[model samples]
Target chain A: MIDFERLRILTESAKYDVSCSSSGSSRRNTKRGLGNAEMGGICHSFTEDGRCISLLKILLTNKCSYDCQYCVNRRSNDVERAEATPEEICELVMSFYRRNMIEGLFLSSAVDQSPDATMEKLLDTVIRLRKLHRFNGYIHLKGIPSADKKLIMRAGEFVDRMSFNIELPSERSLKLLAPQKSKVGILSPMGYMATEKKQALSLKYNKFLPAGQTTQMIVGASPESDGQIIRLTQGLYKKFALKRVYFSSYVPTNEKNALLPTSPVGILREHRLYQVDWLLRFYGFKAEEILDENENLPEGYDPKCHWALKHPEFFPVEINTAPAEVLLRVPGIGFKGAYKIVNARRYGKLDFLDLAKMRIVLKRAINFITCNGKFFGTENQLAVKNTLLLTSTDSVILSQLSMFSNDEIRQSVLQGEI
Target chain B: MITFIFDGTKIGLFTCVFDAYYERRIPKTITDKQVQVGFYDNVYQIETDTQKAKRVSDCLKNCKTIGVLKDVSLALKSGRDDKFTVIFNYVKTVIDNKNLDVSKNFANESVLAFSDLIKQITYEVHRFKGFIRFEESVDGYYYAHFSPDNDITWLLMPHFASRFSNQAFIIHDVKRNVLGMYDGYNSAQVNAEDRQVTVYLSDDEINFKKLWQTYYKSVNIKERKNHRLMKNFLPVRYWEHLPEKQVEIASF
Candidate 1:
């Protein structure tokens, strides 16, 4: 039987790795299976830290050989250690699935003895879950750095998703902080998996990592600027076709180290990176246009609004005639809003009131759009900038002070109501 | 002013729409059976006929895509006072105009309101899927309880039935006095009129609940304590149903 003490030690040690999302895979229940993965993932609950709990994210063993400074499971730490057998993990997952407590399983592990041995044990649990237990729910396995390439390939066939964390931004930092891990040890498997996924698509081999791969980068752990981090993110998406790249704000776990900072990285920096990521993926903004190579994203305004303020020539696009791509670049217009405008304009000419009724964030969009030859925004650029600054500052302060109370403000933020 | 009243059912609402169309007069208001009648309005009580309801549904299916039928059905389940009127106006517009793409016709208030009402109900269904928590009972059956703002018990049945096909489970919406029971093979609905019912949880189940709460507390980083954001994702209204949100007692 798994005791609560062992559970506490294992889950606490695994908490620092934040990849809680369980989306991007769909599977039907078999004849006698217990669960099914919905097309859009289900978030079971949100913890006090405001992060999603979609999967039973836990480590197989909290015993490591290599010592990574930022990691909680490092060998140097004098924390309590624990390990559970494969049968114990299977039993825990089945019980949780039956209770509707979790949607799937996210199994990671420390390098217990060796990378190959760790990967073998992780593979055994998933293989048993699928074949022996007939568990058809989602499973996301974390690829161990420097693990055998053949083991990674075989494991990919059984699981829905896999991730190899590019922990630090640059190679120099990896050598300094995490001496045992190298850049080649991480990127080789990522490159192999990307190629295999592509070949699987062409050869009609379905169910080879159906949910795709995602990686995480520690934002403030290294000295790389936001510009450098975003450039790397672009390369990952462009080259590997990554489903997502998560940016975790560095929390001070080991403050006594000389290389690491004593203070925790603020959440606002992480929030800014997310906004810039949205601009890259959805808004069709290139990394160069967003920020310079040496400069970080501005803390004062959002990436889109910041881009708008820098280039005044792109403003005042006619709402009725601009294409969908142009509408997406507007400050307040989002993917949903842009599509709504494009579809509704086919029926009749749209104005500001109609836009409001359709859920457009008119406060921000008003300055950049002209509705049917009439402009409701300030003609002077300076006045527009000041107005935007005032409104944006109010929202930032309000969100920082107390969130979730005001429905209007939340809707405004959701609908790009900047 | 003419007020049309019908039984609180989807077929009854559709039948009321049929009556409004055949009579060639739009009622000032449409309400379900539970709603109180106005003091000075001319009230018309319409009995629900499946044939008439089928005829209205057939017309909707024949006129537009199946998506329109889904929206109308969801709108009827919203439990709104004048939802029938909103759907009636929307269906009439779709049937009257041949070239009108009702999906894009946000300019029409009835179509817009009908779609928005449907969106609200569907959104509630999606949210409850994630928010519902189940506990194992002494008899080895799993039970979950929730009180959603929208009447979405029926919509949630299919998802749980598919996911927990091997387990016997019951989802009880205490506020609506309705329960959806799934017993391994088939699922059924039970009317829970008493509202006060309890389940005896097993010893291991109680301990599992404590373990889950402990896991929640352990995973939380104190520096990122944003209760506001937490409330935004998991609202305060849902705190009662969550095991993590419950206050721990020293009895164990």
Candidate 2:
């Protein structure tokens, strides 16, 4: 049996990896394996940044070969190190799972020995878990970049998810900061995995790398703007049909890494990226519409609010009259609310008071809407801008205050209550 | 003054909306009776027309996506009494206008307001999915009771049936007094009054619950004790319905 000490260390070490969503996988139980990846509610415990850690999110070993500056397990950092045998890990996971301590396993590792050897150990652990121990619970294994493609492909068939971290957005900064990790090492595996998963899904085989592939890019680690990060996000989603691209706000874990940002990334920029990500997933707003590759998203307001301020004539839309699509564009009237209006408005005329009853943030929406042909907000562009700025400040204050509320802090973290 | 009192839910809301928008009927009852005074209170005795009700349902069903159906259900479950009817009626008018105008201009203030209510309702549905906890009864039936912020018991029915089909279950909406029951084969509705809250358990059922309770205890990371986080997402009130409460109590 793997000692509990090694298990905790390995799992906690892997917690920083964010790609843990279980939706895309369709693997089921076979006579040989003991578990399955059902699509229902076998969810990974995702954090505020949307990194999934619910599974036994851990690494086989924390010892590293490469000196990636942003990594906590970087070569020069001299942190305590531990490694587990494949048999021990398999035994640990099976025991935890039998007790229902975990729904699945999220196994990742640092570049120990060599990338090839690290990849082999990861594969060995999963193979032991599945073939030897009959431990089939959802397994998300990380691919060690620069590891051989044959090993990567063989590993993909056994595990549900495989991610190769882009780590930074641009190739130039990637070379500068993470010289040991190459762009090709990350992108090629992702591209190949995407194509293979598609082909597997089409052929109705348990999709090879069932949840497909996801990559994480550390924001503010390099000087890449939000626009560049988002462009990469959009391109990945469009080209790879990637399930999600998570943003980790760069917090310099290593003090010696001069290439890294000294202070933690402003949470608001992270918040903006999430809101922009929401636009990409639900609302039809493209990355190009929200920000440019050279420019960062506005820190003052959400992307929707910033976009609305840019276009003035669209305002004072009649609340009862606005189409669901237009209602979604209004900063406060979310996509869900827009659809509600489409359904409920069929019965009668709506007013501002009714909007309040629906729990919409009327303070933001009121400026842009008219209730029963009555306009209540400033039409003057300057006045609207000034009022919006004041409201934005208040919103920040509200945002901070709101986080501590029993409802906000708890439910938000558990359900990712955004 | 139309003294047309329909069911005290979204259907009631829709009925009031139909009378006012199409039949020019006035509301005799409201959450605030003062609003119905003078001009708002003037009564036109509602001539009950099933035709109008059918017409309203047809029009709503015609324009209905999965979203609007939820709004109607939410307003029903909201139990807000008369104003819910007011919101429902306003929403109907917006849908009709969509057929005519198909643009933002046609929806007006009331339509948008109705839409916004649907948005909050959807959030409630999403919250319900996470908050819901099933406890096995003595009769071997799994039961979950919730007083959601919005009326969405019916909306939550399909999710439970798909996720836990083999188990016999009851999802009760305490506020609306409605329950969605599934015997696995046929998932159907039952009134809350008919539900008997039983605690009797056979040996096998007790054994299963014990095993389930046993499994629930082992998974948590004891060191990362975020009790504040736990209590916040799941308020203390919900513990009464969960089978694993004693373990949580012991841990604390």
Model 2: residue A110 alpha-carbon error in angstroms: 1.3
Across A58-164, the per-residue lDDT of candidate 2 in tens digits comes to 78898888888887788888777889888777865664453233457777898988889989888988888878877656787888999999999999988887888
Winning candidate number (lDDT): 1
Off by over 4 Å in 2: A26-53, A95-101, A128-137, A201-206, A292-294, A316-323, A370-374, A390-418, B1-252
- Candidate 1 lDDT over B71-161, as tens digits, reads 7767777756667778777777787764566676675677678778888888889888888888988999889998887778889999999
**Reference-based lDDT, each prediction:** 0.83, 0.66
State each model's C-alpha RMSD to the native. 5.9, 10.0
Put down candidate 1 lDDT per residue, A1-418, tens digits, no spaces: 5677887888888777778777888877888887888878898888778888888888899999989998878899878899999888888888777777788889999999989999999999999898888898889999999999999999999898999999998999889888999899899999999999999989988689988999998989889999888999999999998999989999877547888887898888899899989988988999999995438887766888888878889988898999998999898899988988898788789988888988888878889999999999976554455445535336523343146446645555566544
Per TM-score, the best of the predicted structures is 1
- Classify candidate 1 by CAPRI docking class: medium
Scanning candidate 2 chain A in windows of ten residues, the lowest lDDT window is A44-53
TM-score of 1: 0.91
